[model samples]
Target: MEFADRVILVTGASSGLGRHAARALALAGATVVLLGRHEKRLDGVYDDILAAGGAQPVIMPFDLAEADDPRFNALAATLAHQLGRLDGILHSAAQFIKLSKLEHQRLKHWEAAFATNLMAPFALTRACLPLLEGAEDAAVLFSAEEHGLNPGPYWGGFGLSQAALIALAELFAAEHQDNPNLRFNVLIPGPVSSPMRHRTHPGEVPENLPKPESLLPFYLTWLGPQSRGRSGEVIRPDLGYDPSRQD
Candidate 1:
């Protein structure tokens, strides 16, 4: 689907799925706002999008883990001053330091994981609500994981944060159910051959997993107008699920 005139923000835009999604969204005619901590990587993605003839993207360099509510609010204000309105926000940023049993996990590790995977998305979305509401259609998508839904041994704080994201998505959807302009949903990009997956499942063969770009169709369907009126749902592209099918 085309996103002509739409302005979308993507966290973790420096690399992996976030990078791929940003490029694809830009190519689809959306003006992208690239958010990430790494200024160098963000610039690379920005340049790639420009070279590909995509809309000139805005690079927002902010560390999600260290940002507070005021910082997020300020970001929203900046976006409003620049783009006027926000059509979508894709929460693709995540942190997984390591896999450890609950008893073995350090307090700092748990805090860091929660801050990036849960708190940042929640805070950013809350701050951007006003901008999102200004659009005719807006979407907030949270990146989920298989371990989050089906918790298993040694998943640790990373898994817990992901599980919380599902709840966060559902809560946002419920809160905005009456507001036809906004929607929220969770997406699980299962077994993608990305750095996170490589780190989490080092034993798995990289070639066996789907490429990050493979999720573009699903991403477009959910973030664009195609999935309008569809919210509070958990989408699993790896399951061959068709989001267009309401049934």
Candidate 2:
């Protein structure tokens, strides 16, 4: 129970990387606060955690793209009131609107992409700064993607927003470099057999890609005590991280 007594928030807990990360964090003994727009899906995750003997999870149904400052502040206030402290945050929520050319990308698509991928994280993190800083050791994990690191054709706003998300993580780490309690880093879970991958690459065989569960170790290491003092990094497990070895 590396994360025993810790409280962690996971956005996009309805599906994909976020859902898997939420369950993994809870299993490792963290009280997982599942945040997403889909109430039913969040309930499923909450039940899964209980059935697996993990900590009881909280379901917070929220639309990331549409959330405003008041909503973000209220979320922080609620966490502070209920959880007392926040130990970690996994910004796994994302918005993707298919593969399209830069010119073909609609204004609304860009707005939604940046809102969920970049703005929401910024607002939430800002609101929860005091709670995170209050913890003995707090970590924030921002999810990035291959297209964000290396922008190519047809990636559009989704790629750009994620690229900004990477920068946001770096900035957070740099700003708090002197603070011993806080750490921020980005994780790039590449080509996993996830819903997003299927939507982006319809022709690809799902069996060929690693299952979402395979990336749990990476999430655990980053969000848990194993990653102490590790900040401002863009970690790519698919690139060369050896999960078999200890961090």
**Alpha-carbon RMSD of each model:** 4.7, 4.2
- C-alpha local distance difference test of each model: 0.91, 0.90
**Highest lDDT scorer:** 1
lDDT per residue for candidate 1 within 1-247, as digits (tens), equals: 3899999999999989999999999999999999999999999999999998898899999999999999999999999999898999999999996887788999999899999999999999999999999899999999989888987789988888999989999999999999988999999998787889889988777776778878999889999999999999999886443324332
Please estimate how well model 1 matches the true structure, expressed as its whole-model Cα lDDT: 0.91
* TM-score for predicted model 1 compared with the true structure: 0.95
Mind sharing the TM-score for model 2? 0.95
Candidate 2 local distance difference test against the native: 0.90
**Model 2 residue 158 distance off true place after TM-score fit, in angstroms:** 1.0
Give the C-alpha miss distance for residue 65 in model 2, angstroms: 0.6
Q: How many backbone clashes does candidate 2 have?
A: 0
Which residue runs of candidate 1 sit more than 4 Å off their true CA positions? 239-247
TM-score of each: 0.95, 0.95
